[model samples]
Target: MKLYHYPLSGHAHRARLFMSLLGIPHELVEVDLKSGAHKTPEFLALNSFGQVPVLDDNGTMISDSNAILVYLATKLGRTDWLPTDAKGAAGVQRWLSVAAGDVAFGPAAARLVTVFGAKFNPEDVIGRAHVLLKRLEAHLADRDWVVGTGPTIADVALYSYLSSAPEGNVDLSAYPRVNALLRRIEALPGFVPFAKTAVGLAAAA
Candidate 1:
């Protein structure tokens, strides 16, 4: 398998994290998003969206980080990572949705704004982030992981960007439960730190 990815992308990190955790041996093909490599004809053939983190599992090409997680988990027959039971599957799916929806819009996009200077309306995203963080804090009050007793794809999907909320000027200090959840995910074996990159602005030297 070959993964086309950018190191700084949380979505790309999701695939990398899962592969590392499962000890899946594959090649990493870095896509230069700044140089528009992902928009080239070669990459467009793999994914029309022109996104990073496209996985080529032999002949089967999969895009979207969450979808890739499902594909890999199913292929490996590691249902524990994704759960097979109806209710359990739904719970996993719910968190994946949260990752894509609220998490992406809030922490991820906000980080893009703060880090890369992306045109983000702070009044718009920051308030939404606070609301989402509060809800997550309350939800995680009694659970270690998002869905089940152990870590699942849901946790992998949300952990990257959500854990880096401080970079976006989103104060996670208000959410102790959510912070604990982040620590738990980080304490997992084979965990990798999210790589920082020049997104919207250059980091202070």
Candidate 2:
């Protein structure tokens, strides 16, 4: 298996991290986002959006972090990572949606403004992050994992951005439950970390 990704991309990190957690053997191909390598024809062919974390297993290819996660979990026959029951599956999907929506527009967007110099309003994006964080903090209060007693893809989906939210100027200190969730994920065997980028509001402050 091969994973084409940028080290600093949370989307890519989620895919890579899950693969590691599953103990799947894969190679990491770092896409040179700074050099615009992802915009090339070869790269776009793999992902029309030209995003990082495109996975190639044999001749099969998949794009999008959450999509890749589902593929690997299903392929590995690990229902624990992705439950098969209708309600359980729905639970995992809910957080995947949150990862793409709330997490994306919140902490991820805030980081984009500082790290990538994107044009998002810092106050708006950061505020969005806090809103989502408070909700997650409450939701995770009595739960060790996102959807069940054990770890699942839902936990993996929310791990990266929430752990790195501070880098986007969204503090995690107020969210003890969320922080505990992060600590539990980190303690999981075979866990891999998302690479840290030094550019963000936390650095400036």
Candidate 3:
């Protein structure tokens, strides 16, 4: 298996974290997003959309971080990270939606703008991110993880971007509950720190 990703990307970090937790061995192929490497003809053949964190498992290609999480969890028989029961599954899915939607658009985009100069309206997204953080704070008030009583793909999917929210100047001082959740995820065994480039982007092109 080959994971084409940028080391600093939170989306890519989610996949790396899961692979480490599952003890799955695969080659890490870095894609350079700055130099337009992801847009090149050679890379476009692998993923027409030309995004980082594209996973090549044998001949099967999977894009999107959450989809990769589901694929790996299923393949490694680590369903505990993604429960089989309908309610449990839905709970995980719900958080996944939050990760892709609110989390991505708000804190994640805010960070990209601050650190990478991505064209985003930080003032608008910062307020939205605060609202999302409040929701997470309330949800995590009495729970250790997002979905199940234990950590799940939901937590992994959300942790990377949420942990780095401060990079975007989004203060986390008010969300103690969310802070606790971040600490718990950081303390997980076999956890690999999300590696970011000095420029705050992923390692691969």
Name the better of 2 and 3 by lDDT.
2
lDDT tens string, model 3, 2-109? 999997789999998898888888899999988899999999998898887899999999998999999998887787899999999999999999999999999899
Clashes of 1: 5
The estimated TM-scores of all candidates read 0.94, 0.96, 0.93
**lDDT per residue as tens, model 1, 1-205:** 9999998789999999998888899899999988999999999999999997999999899999999999999999998898999999999999999999999898888888876678989767877788899999889888888998998999999988887777777778789888888888888888887886543322331
**Model 1 lDDT at residue 12:** 96
lDDT of each: 0.87, 0.90, 0.87
Give residue 62's error in model 1 in angstroms: 0.3
User: In model 2, where is the ten-residue run with the lowest total lDDT?
Assistant: 196-205
Q: Which structure among the candidates has the greatest lDDT? A: 2
Q: In model 1, state the lDDT of residue 78.
A: 92
Positional deviation of residue 198's Cα in model 2 after best superposition, in angstroms: 2.5
Model 2 CA deviation exceeding 4 Å by range: 201-205
The lowest-lDDT stretch of 10 consecutive residues in candidate 1 is 196-205
**Any idea how many clashes model 2 has?**
0
